[model samples]
Target: MAEESRKIIHVDMDAFYASVEQLDNPELKGKPLAVGGGGARGVVAAASYEARKFGVHSAMSGQLARKKCPELIFVSPRFNRYREISHSIREIFFEYTDLVEPLSLDEAYLDVSQNKTGMPSATLLAREIRQRILKTTGLTASAGISVNKFLAKIASDVNKPNGQKTIPPEEVHDFLMQLEVRKFFGVGKVTAEKMYRLGIFTGADLHSKDEDFLTTHFGNSGAHYYKVVRGIHNSPVQPSRIPKSIGAERTFRENLSSEIFMLEKLEGIAEELEKRLGSKDRAGKTITLKIKYSDFQLQTRSHTGGHFVSKKAEILAIARELLYQQPLRESVRLLGISLSNLNTEQDSSAPAAEDVSVQLRFDF
Candidate 1:
């Protein structure tokens, strides 16, 4: 299949966790709300649009969120309910195309170049998918339609929270050229600042740099930047996504200065991690311990053994070893445990070779 002929759509649920909370309880619908892992020390997992109006958002500390939106309501996360809803959403995606690559519980990329419904236009498919998802889940979704994933993903955010955007093949070049560098998917705060320092503030500026100069500054990702700026991202939509690691973490109500308190928290985190591994029927040789200090400084220590550990005792033991391996830099507020290099990591079986022929004239 030619790159220009591909039709990709990125479907993103609007404020998914907060929306679910709003759906389950009528009182939270119109109020400023933050769905959190827990209250007090926990970070905002998701913020309702009402909360966002006051500059509240996910990963904002609860303390700050409260200051920003004094009337904000904090609710505990319900993973089981979120997963049940996510499964239903995935079912909706599979109804249209098998080439769905889920980025998380709330967003996914789909290749409907050859759709199950024989729909010639990808824009209509996106509208119908969003409509179906709303009818089925009572939740709204936004979509982006384009020739490839990169354009589609960015487009999804342009008109958000129940809106959709399309960037057809012909307009992709100009669309990318005028785009701000900060709007690029992987360009976070640090990267955006660096790009600013380098005078690469827009796609046009990025396209002005050679691959060598980009590689010199951005390492391996420079090559990727060089490709995406010209609307040249060609990575296929991988349906068989693999988990790189599995982990669980918890935030404490107060920062603990004692290692004993840290160890006690590790036990519970390990127990949650053990259940997660069991659910996936997975175990790995690598165990990592993550720490967040009172000042929000984050650190991680990892150890990989020859043997894999799936049980609670073994996981807790390794986590304990990692905890003691380094002295506390500061009073800690968060702890986590994770496993990687799983048994599921094996030689890649090739994705099915296929062909696609779609109408190149997409109406964005």
Candidate 2:
């Protein structure tokens, strides 16, 4: 028997944080605005459409953003307000289907193949969802409708800032063939450059390369590229997806070479990780340390303990070991710590409220 096709929709809010600020403050609308810290070492969390016109964007340094748009108004992010709005939006989604996978506070992938509305057309459903969001939240959202998550996500960005696009199953092949290699999902700058060097500038070029050839050139991910280029993604929209890891990272204004300075930075990173784990009431067995050198090279080191680790002291101790286990290779510009192999089961020996514990494991 032939397989049944799935209907997927990817919804993305337009400049969510900055737009929320503008919605609350009417005077801020139509002006260049950014939401983030305004300190010299601060980064822009979000930039309004107006700010983007002046080349301002999210994750840009406050100093550089100001230089780009001298009149850019910087407003601190109100995460609580955003969360409230997100909850309201999610309620709207549940009205359609329970199979909703949230990517962030403002974006989600919805499996609307079997929906409550009994709507036969995914495009119509996307339009209805976008309209409902605008009506209920006083915010606009863009949506993409397709047969799978990968195609739906790409379609959503076609006509952005309050628009919707749908790629029917029959049109998938031609649409993908014309797509630029860089626009495909998971094709970052490095991968795109590699493709360009290999004369794979478009999906058509990528499609011409056989599975074996791509695998030889790109490893396991090469097989993924081979499938996606031919419009053959089968990844599902899983609503119950739990994060495999939690992490915190920071980039310094100046690179540090001294071991003493690196340790001090690791302490702060560990504290941040502890706070994050505490908020989620989560503990993990493996701790991974990530470092980015001034030249942008990245390195990671991990140690898995026998017991779950969540406490500040435990996290700090593990992080300290990971940092000093190896000699400094170069000046470091970024530092990060992450916890994986999360403990989801309850423990009886540990405290009744916080039953988190750890077990020793191998280190590499």
Q: Write down the TM-score for model 1.
A: 0.86
Question: Model 2 over residues 1-364: C-alpha lDDT tens digits?
Answer: 2254688899999999999999999999999999997776677999999999999999787888999999999999999999999999999999999999999999999999888999988888889999999999999999998887888999999998899888887778889889999999889999999999999999899999999999998998998898788776766788987788999998998889997898888889888999999998999999999998876678999999999989878887888898889897999989999999897643547753321111111110
Candidate 1 per-residue C-alpha lDDT over 242-339 given as tens digits, one digit per residue, 9 for 90 to 100: 79899999877789899998889989999999999999999999999999999988899999999989999999998999999979988998899999
Error of 2 at 145 (Å): 0.3
Kindly state the number of residue pairs that clash in model 1.
0
Clashes of each: 0, 8
As for candidate 2, its clashing pairs are 305-359, 306-358, 306-359, 306-360, 307-358, 307-359, 308-357, 308-358
Model 2 root mean square deviation, Cα atoms: 9.3
- Using lDDT, give the best candidate's number: 1
